[model samples]
Target: MKIGIFGGSFDPIHNGHINLALSVIDMLTLNKLIIIPASSPPHKEISGLASKNDRFNMCSIVANCYDGMEVSCMEIKRGGKSYTIDTLKEIRSVYKDDEIYLILGSDMFFSIKDFKCSSEIFKMCTLCVVPRRAQETDCIREYASFLRNIGASVVVLDIAPIEISSTQVRERLKSNRDISKFLPGNVEQYIREKRLYGLGGEYLIKEYKSILSKLLDKNRYSHSIKVSEKAIYLAKKYGVDVRKAELAGLLHDITKQMPDKEHLIMFEKYNIKLSDIELKNKKLWHAISGALYIKNILKIDDEDIMNSVRYHTTGRENMSELEKIIFVADFISDDRVFNGVETIREIAEDNLDKAVAKGASITIVHLLEKNKLIDHNTLSAYNRYTSNFI
Candidate 1:
């Protein structure tokens, strides 16, 4: 039987890690792949690392998502420096008759000379190294050849480059950016629910979205999800904080289905006083009301996030990038089949201001045709766009 060993800190496993594991297993035709989470990594510092149990559990969660994949607490259970030499020795002893292959990324392979009993590692298992994109084959082959001269069996696997790094995932999570696309849905939900990465409260996205769905009709809930997706797209395009964009888009219409009386009651309870024009225009009530509810009831006090929700409807002058992202996302959401939507979407990809201006123009035209009131902010946004972007 052929067994593969893939080990890492796996602080929180992401999709790229999962994909790489799958690729290696398929290429090597290994009967079983063991994923080991390190208790302590000797090469680099894990300053804000999660607990060993959390890392082990996360690896288990990810490994369980696939067949032929299993989690091993060998490093964590051993309770020391998490040396691979020791782990491999233990693994070899357990599966004495099995052919063993040790898998790692090219970066890790380059550092093998420093590992304790480095030569002993090769005697125990063949080394399979996955190269990073832009890592030249000549360089990899040269190093692999050098290892061969030293009695080490080094095989470089030409796996597809998944341009994701654990460092990038951690940084995005720390900066309040949405990692939904980078992580499995269940794992994302787990991280959010556990309040990992300092994202506390209703920041627990999936549960909050579920609660919102119950409060909304199917169509509206679908729209909210689409808007959230589009918001994230624009956020990435513009380098805005995606987490804030998603939250603003998701909750932008929380108060949309409510009657005027309900908005009034919420406003009164929150002690929120609106302008005469805002009070007269019932359509604009939801934005301010939603902002109030998010901060007061949900206890999310991020000023930028609240502002994004507050201005998604009418859109204030000099809005934040996140506000611009949500406004444009909500306007150009996938469910919106209005004329010029395709045009606005194309423009929004490279020119956000021009797209928002086009959206504002469309909203203004519809209001005029119905002889409904238009907010000054909407007019200002249109003027701003036409003057600067047209």
Candidate 2:
């Protein structure tokens, strides 16, 4: 018997996975292809992932579409961290005389040597790598050398490159964007029917509620609600997507009141490397860190919303109208009573550029009076937008 192994997280198997499987089967002329969903991939963390059963079932739906493709719950049933060597060893025990072809994408192939028991695993199965996109220029020859060093049989198959990815599909779904073109018809319908990706669902509201429950200060919560209201209002005014604006507003200050240690930990966990200035001025980090927390925890995919959160505190050049609205709203919210805030608020209602310029000027003057280092974004925003004030 001839068997081919195709393994992945299959978070929600999309067309790209289907295409890769089909291409490999046709290219290898294999008798059977087993689709294995990892129980837990070692390299990547599974955040916001559906249950193992959900992922396995979706893989079954995709596998049944082709005659030669078969879905295996081997990794899921094994019920611990999934490793390729253990999977191959199990398969070898089941099919003693079969020739095994481990089908992998170019991206995964480059990191083959890092797999657990990689040397022994290569001895058990022949490696079949498909170049889905650009060649692995960074370390292709090095990887090949490492694989051959272990006396492994390897073949690289060239296939039509499909740029679609599960992350891109998930992000599109999160934004209520169209993904029909990138997913199987049944799979797409299933996701929609199940209210997957939280589109038009109460999941986002629930997440907001949970976050709010942890916040003790009623005033801070009120400010968050006000920012959300203002963001929606400005989004409508600027013809931007209203829901995205609302989400950005709601999550912009999520970390505002967290302890410094907790905030730093969150930043590090999310891979947000703060500069020395950012670390010293904890105020600026809340915006950047808050944006990352929302994206990673709440799974918000609106780049406009994320960027709005990122640059909310430090106004940036060429900011989208939405970002400017959030920035000005935060500066002039009802609780605020700074010296020229009223004038800035009045300007914000009519002209965003004038409002942003006034706000940036205020921030710059205050920072200068305090002898603080101003961020480049703030300086650029003041220069570009202050022309209106002149």
Candidate 3:
């Protein structure tokens, strides 16, 4: 059996790495390719590098797409300066009968002479030189010829060049560019949700979670989590950004931590003009207060998220997609226990407009039955939907 050994830092393995793995497997017609993610790369600094676990996880993510490819954490398990010589010796011990091939790019091929126990490495396996499109073809040929002169076995394969790099991936994520085009959907989702590589680095999501935990009561905090999950589901279904939806949902009830008097105080502090009936209603203050607190205190400038938190309780007319999502999410969250909740949730599955209109109508009727004051925005929101849909 011919086995290929492909190793790299795979800091944040991108499409290019996946392409290379696929090409090498097909070109060599290998039975199995063992992909090694470096635990501690001696050549490169580990400052911006992802954790060993993350790198290994990303490698596994790519390996899943290609048959006969496997991710081995040998280097990581070995720990401390992942020397190629050691890895080869360990593999040699396992598969004594199989023909081993070591895959490297043109860049690595040129510098292999400096590798620890370089001579012993060649004896262990044939150095498969995968030419990078960035380098000159003539230079690659000349290097291959030189390696032959020095009595090293080398196989140069002509593979389609995919120009993506991990650096480019990191840069795109840092700048908030659309990197979905360059990464697998699952990998992209992991990076986005974990706020990896500075996508949401400006604000510490965990820090906010901690602050929220300290502020909100147990029940209210649980409700926030439920709303966030429901909002994320809706966001994904409706093609809205899931990250934004989650954040909006988390902050939607930020003011719920405050007492009734504090909500009233926050309302007046923010210069909000509430109706005579709304002034006495503490329940109506959290939505408006949450929006203002996150915007002013948290310094969040995202209007989509701000509006989502603002209108989550009392949805307004001509609401944004995010606004509608939060409004529906709050009403149908898992913690909610009321009549017709299941009906609105079912309606939400197929029709957002219908759900929003129905939810607003239900809230209005509930308030009227109690002889409570209804906010004008809430009334206007219902009228807007009825006039348009009806």
Q: Could you say which candidate leads in TM-score?
A: 3
In candidate 1, residue 315 scores what lDDT? 80
- In order of appearance, the predictions have TM-scores of 0.54, 0.52, 0.56
lDDT of 3 by residue, 227-319 (tens): 989999999989988888888988899988688777777778888887775677778778888888998898889998998888887788989
CA lDDT of every candidate = 0.84, 0.81, 0.85
Candidate 3 ranges with C-alpha deviation above 4 Å: 202-390
Q: For residue 315, what is the lDDT in candidate 3?
A: 85
Q: After superposition, how far is residue 265 of candidate 3 from its true place, in Å?
A: 22
Cα RMSD for candidates in order: 11.2, 16.1, 14.6
Instruction: Select the stronger candidate by lDDT from 1 and 2.
Output: 1
Report the C-alpha lDDT of model 1 over 314-374, residue by residue, as the tens digit: 8866778888898899988999998888998898987988887887888899889989888
Going through the candidates in order, what is the number of backbone clashes in each?
A: 0, 0, 0
Please give me the total number of clashing residue pairs in predicted model 3: 0
Instruction: For model 2, state the Cα shift of residue 164 in Å.
Output: 1.5
Q: Rank the candidates by lDDT, best first.
A: 3, 1, 2
